[model samples]
Target: MDDGSAPAAGGYVLGSTDREMARLAALSEVYGPVTAAWLDSAGLRPGATVVDVGCGPGDVSLAAAERVGPTGTVLGLDAAPRPLELARARAAAAGLRNVSFEQADVTRWRPPAPVDAVVGRLILVHLPDPVAQVARLAGTVRPGGVVAFADVALSTRAAQPELPLLTAFNAWLLGTFTRSGRPVDMALRLTGVFRAAGLPDPVLTAAAPLERGGDAVGWSVVAGDVAGLLPVMERTGVATREEIGPETFEQRLRAQAAEHDAVLVNPLVVGAVARTPDGGG
Candidate 1:
């Protein structure tokens, strides 16, 4: 992987759009608590500096700031400008002076000084070489500092009273990532990546969201995620406009869920935390 500086011209595979921003915001609401727990387990604490890589919309960064408090500092980094702008706005609105967002490519970014921890969520799967990327992240922190990440293993998704449309859309999304040279289940390989990066064996944990019928928030979260990808899925021919049109696809999913009393189980999110050695990289 590159050194975290050379950003892709178009940035993230899921292009930044209004729908994508909404999706990210919903995801933060849904997953933020668990992610905060994971980061805390990874050794983030009051007055400790941290960096949130691929910090889209700054949810994790905001959480980190809350954890680290006023004395501590958190920097949010992403290649996309739109999300960074939103992140900045949210931070300002939230009155979080300890956190800041910057537009930077994780693959080529290098922190000015070593920090206490480096963290990212849902970003490793989009990289070509997650192991190398992890290594680079490890290098950004001080010795004995932590490197933590969370990502989805897309292949592990399942639903009860299965919604065919939802399932097929997920499959198509995974295929789109694969065709674009990204790993769809990088979380499953995170331990190996940490080891290959020369970090000690990482502590790993996983969770999945199980949303039952009539949960609008849950369904909206799912819909936002799927809708954000519809354009790319159609453009790549992984799906067709008629098959996965943004307007009706989510409605169909909701109808299916309501009709079947369905239980929607999204992909397992695997989190890994490793400590850099006493001798820095």
Candidate 2:
């Protein structure tokens, strides 16, 4: 749902701090349904095998395990070891024996064996060459396997009544991403990226929730991200801790939302799923 995964060459702006890890969990909760729908659209079935790239703490990997059932297996790969450890614990706690987590650089990782499908969420945005990476991932699957990915589109953020604080934070988030050299609109470009990856144009879906008032999950999602990104925002000159007031950010967002009676449309997430060509092209 929210940010995860470091680039193969390193520098994932959202560092792997405890605060960031908690933020990622909150984000997964918010984005879980959307990602579930994406996996369904990818045609995961019982007995299918899947490899989840940049799986973070295995939220999506665990979901895929449920989808593919006991007979199926899931291998989740990420560049960070701490997240992988968390992912392992989560799977263990959930009693999901079918899913496993591993630590590896996404660009350099290879499947131990050909799998039914390859999937990722909120990962490509961190990569320098997503198209080539997608192509490589596609090749790791079986002949008719699926290649699906999900990413965020920050430009789609809006507010019905226009809460001032929400608007300001949205701008800060977008600005930070832009200045940090991350494509703020990777979700909007999935089609082109998939096609350029030498795969067919994917079936695309976009989703965003209109979170209303202070109590909504969106508030926490944004606040958590702001907390995680505070350092980057400061280093990149996009924003400063003093200016952002991380300690009061969530409170301020809730207060403004309550004051304005607004409904905030969270960032849009775009998902794309394409099938590998026959004969494993």
Candidate 3:
């Protein structure tokens, strides 16, 4: 893997204490089961080995362990130790000896053996070289091993009308990430990454956005949130508000929260599965 210069190796923006990550988990809990199901359906056996990349808090790692049963093993790796510690604690609480979590930049890390499946959720987007990383991941799969991944588009558009301010804010937010070269569009371009890395074409699937109302409403509760992202967006000209009226965002959040049914929209998450050149099932 040539240890390509790592991008924010251990500085992943999504941290345990970050409010945005907290809200994201709340929403993604409902959305991620679909992705987990696909991973479970692919290359899983009583003794299969699965590698979960960017395995934050080991939710998917533990889940994969359960799916593969005690006979199988799940190794989840991440660049950050905070998430790994949480993942370890979770596994410990569940007595999931089959699952292990380690901390290392995946770009410089390699698996001890070719695994049955290599998976990552919302990982590649943060990478400086998404294509190269995908290729590197392909190298970890056993002959005919599977690679499954999922991510979302930067923009979460909806047919339903939205507050003009929120709509504009969302648009600016998308550009902010894109300018930094980590656009959410990676959700769909995974096929390109695979092809560019010379891996087999994948079977792709999608899960559409589901509304998340209640206390979770407002931009603060979405992807990056405006506060943590405002500085970056402003520097890049992705967003510029003339004035942020006091508690305006808070009021909007409260309003949306009250609706409880305010339909939140997001791009469909695209998931893919592919095999290595060899036909080892």
Candidate 4:
């Protein structure tokens, strides 16, 4: 919203914090633990200063601090303050003082100093111009510092005979993105975005949905994702917001999860890790 320009003025994030975070949590599925592994695999060493763009609720930021250890610093940037506030609480609860959260629309803001790594998870999709955002991120990290992100891949094809509804949901989600001006193709463009910003070509990898426990342990979070995506689908007239009632949606998704004898997870999300050149990009 707000035209993706300068800082939004104390604006609310389109939905209640509880619901919004829950929505983000669902579509993101395994982002937290997966991010920890992604950073480790990238060789982000101890004491590495990290910036987590779109650090909603701050799980990735705290994880980065844990991986980097006490010597490192983590700064999380986000557009909305409610999520940042929650992130701060999460950091405190996790006893991770090395990480802090800031409220700034990163599209118009840049980190003041080079960081050891720049990361975002499920974040770039909200940007109106992700290419420009990646270019700006390239400027914030030191030469050879790692920069990486992961998001849903639209080009993926699902062969989930067992979960056609879930598969259909994925298609509708991408359509919603297209209608909202935040096309899903950006998910496939991370590597190109890195290269275009003059950074090293990114090493790409992807994840397939695996079976989850029937309880999901994070079902409430799934409700949040339904909330987040509902707007997109509604805007595109793909689904009426009423049809996507969070409770009913989660109930159905959980039912689908039960049918999970093993169906493909629709989001063939891609993750990329790249080194910033020895010289500024």
Candidate 5:
């Protein structure tokens, strides 16, 4: 959920285009397992209500709805209306009546009532002040309710054979994000964010997908991200259109993986799960 709602705070660098939405769908596949685990650790159960902040296309929101069962409800919020529209359509397609979507700036939006949990993924990094935002979200949940989030740590990407193209891809991703003024290190800072939010110390877990040989989904995600950020790369001088060669980006990445019999490790996604104070501390 890029903040077209608040451009001065540096709107979501990755624009909410169809291509970016597709990238998010692919990313959901990669992230689904780890996210489910995070929710489990946070004790998100059936009959609980959750709010998915910055829910692009409603992936996480839909997942939470499934976990919370028919009696529970999920509200998916995003600053971009396009994703919210897509999210509604997806919920309908999935026959998930318990989940719904809305468009609003997370920093300013307030829930009508306290929920059982408030969650987000890949959202805090785009915020101007993640700690304050976490505190605000924490406030939206009932005392002892769950507050869980996940973010990428690009620096955790690695390859066993150290493929050059993979290296370049990592550099392009990190450079573009850094230049956009987003926190590239948000994953590592989750603990401090939770502590400062006045929540209990969160249980942190991090995982990276490893792909070896043949055509890999990891490469597709990388290519999709580069494709989505081409304009940003050019604007920020991270890399130029000619240099990236978006047309063959995936092919080049796969070719390198095959040639070196390399094992590619995608970025690490870190999850933090904590509960609001039972005493409302």
Candidate 6:
């Protein structure tokens, strides 16, 4: 196992903080099912081999392992060691022997063998050149193998009954990410990325609207994400602690939701799947 304290290089804006880790864990639980369905659509099979790029905490990797069953192998790769530690621990706790993790930068890491598929979630948007990265990733899989990804288009998010704080907070978040040079709406570009990678145009699917109020999970997910981005928000002058502390923001959001009977529609999460050219060796 790699040391967990080494800092990540490249242009990753979201550093590994406790708050960010919590957000990733919550997000995994919320979006794992959607990722699994996307993998199925990519034709993942019971005995196929898959590589999960930027596999934070290994949630989707574990899901893929379950889908591929005992005979298959799932490799979860990440540049950060902290998340890989968590991922390995989770896989161990789940007694999933078929799944394993490695610490390596996704941009430079090449698989020891060609895999049946390559997949990632919310990873490409952080890259400086996501289409180029996708093309590189496509080389690690066998010809005709699957390459799939999922990302969020934050601009598409909306709140019913129109909560002002929520709206402002979302704007600040988008500005923060945008200023950092990350694409806040990477999902909308998946087809182009695939085509640029020399693969056929990808088939795309969007996750159903996530409704708030049935439980606190949805609210918690949003709160954690916003909380984790507070430092960036502050640095970018997008927001400040005095204006939007995590606790205060959650309280206000919940109060407004209750008062207005509002439901929060999360940003659209889009999944795309494409296959490498069959003749490409």
TM-score of 6: 0.91
What do the candidate models score in CA lDDT, each in turn?
0.79, 0.85, 0.68, 0.68, 0.85, 0.81
Reference-based TM-score, model 1:
0.91
Better of 3 and 6 by lDDT: 6
Cα shift from native, residue 237, model 6 (Å): 1.9
Q: List the residue pairs that clash in candidate 2.
A: none
Residues 155-203 of candidate 3 have per-residue lDDT tens digits of: 7554243555456666766776766556667777888888888887888
The alpha-carbon deviation from the true structure for residue 175 of candidate 2, after best TM-score superposition, in angstroms, is 1.6
Q: On residues 1-281, what C-alpha lDDT tens digit does candidate 1 reach at each position?
A: 12223234223666677877887777776666678678777877889899999998998899889889999999999988889999999999999999998888789999889999999999887776788888988998998898999988877666688778778877887777766567777778888888999999999877776767755455666677566666566656688867766687678878888888888776778889988899644
lDDT (Cα) of model 5: 0.85
Report the number of clashing residue pairs per model.
9, 0, 0, 4, 0, 0
Q: Candidate 3: where are CA atoms >4 Å away? A: 1-11, 212-220, 234-251, 254-261, 279-281
The reply for model 1, stretches above 4 Å from the true place, is: 1-11
**Tens digits of per-residue lDDT for model 2 on 55-110?**
98888899999999999999999888888999999999999999998888889898
TM per candidate comes to 0.91, 0.93, 0.83, 0.82, 0.94, 0.91
- Minimal lDDT window, size 10, model 4: 2-11
Q: What is the C-alpha RMSD of each candidate to the true structure, in Å?
A: 3.9, 2.9, 4.5, 4.2, 2.3, 3.2
Return the clash pairs for model 5, or none.
Answer: none
Clashing pairs in 3: none
Top TM-score: which candidate number? 5
How far does residue 23 in candidate 4 sit from its true spot (Å)?
3.4
